[model samples]
Target: MYKRILLPTDGSELSHACVTAGLEFAQQLQAEVVAVYVAGNYQYPLYVDILPPNGPTEEEYQAAMQTLAESYLQPVREAAAAAGLACQQVIQFNDSTAKEIVHTAQEYACDLIFMGSHGRSGLGQFILGSVTTKVLSLCLIPVLVHRIKHH
Candidate 1:
């Protein structure tokens, strides 16, 4: 029933599974997929003066992050093409992953968001904060989280 599906991936093995599942679901529903990669703005450490002399410049770090984000989204684009489904790629530079994801879904008018869950423990989730959890709580749209099992 979904007309447009948003798939947010981080290029991790867990996210790869979600990409595969989300694409299959989109194919079945004849829905368009919007794949997004969110990159946080990198900030140099405060003690730059005392830091290593050969540290990468801010511009260089940003470029590398963008390149990595592109690599993460490339396979998703190819998979969509192979499935004969219309797809779009988005790159967002924001600090809050969940906020960016929700904003993208709203901006794109996507009905469903399919993403992977890292499946952190309760304590770990509390300490590190769970992006999927935050998205679920904040998003108005329906979210389908694929939890990958580690063997």
Candidate 2:
């Protein structure tokens, strides 16, 4: 019973799985889809007094980040088009991805969020933490987590 489905993707294979599942659910519910990519924030300090300057330039880093964020949306866009659903996309650069996702959902008036679960086992999950878990903790909308099993 979803009217607006928000799908956040990162261009990972797992995210693709999530998109596929989300598309099916959205189609079944006759819902519109919103694809979002949250660019990880840049928090490093600017160091202009380095000895030998051969590192990536500020403009280069920004361009690379933007490319990565946009690249993640390509497959999702194709999938939505093939499914014949009304689709929209947004790219956000945020320190907290979970927070951005929840905020976007509210901003877009989405009813449900379909996302992929990074199937990390006990120890790995404990060490790395999980964006999906964080999103679930803060989101007011329903979240469907698609766990892609790796063989």
Q: Which candidate achieves the best lDDT against the true structure?
A: 1
* lDDT for each residue of candidate 1 in 1-151, tens digit (9 for 90 to 100): 8999999998876688889999999999999999999998877778867755787787888889889999999999999999999999999989999999999999999999998765445554334238988999999999997765556
User: Residue by residue across 1-151, what tens digits does model 2's lDDT show?
Assistant: 7899999987776577878899988989889999999887654556546623655565766778888877888777888899899899888878899999999999999999998776445554333237888999999889987766556
Model 1, stretches more than 4 Å misplaced?
47-52, 120-129, 149-151
Candidate 1: RMSD over Cα atoms? Answer: 3.1
Q: List where candidate 2 sits over 4 angstroms from the true fold.
A: 46-52, 120-129
> Whole-model lDDT, candidate 1?
0.88
Give RMSD to native, each candidate.
3.1, 2.8
Question: Ten-residue segment with the worst summed lDDT in candidate 1?
Answer: 120-129
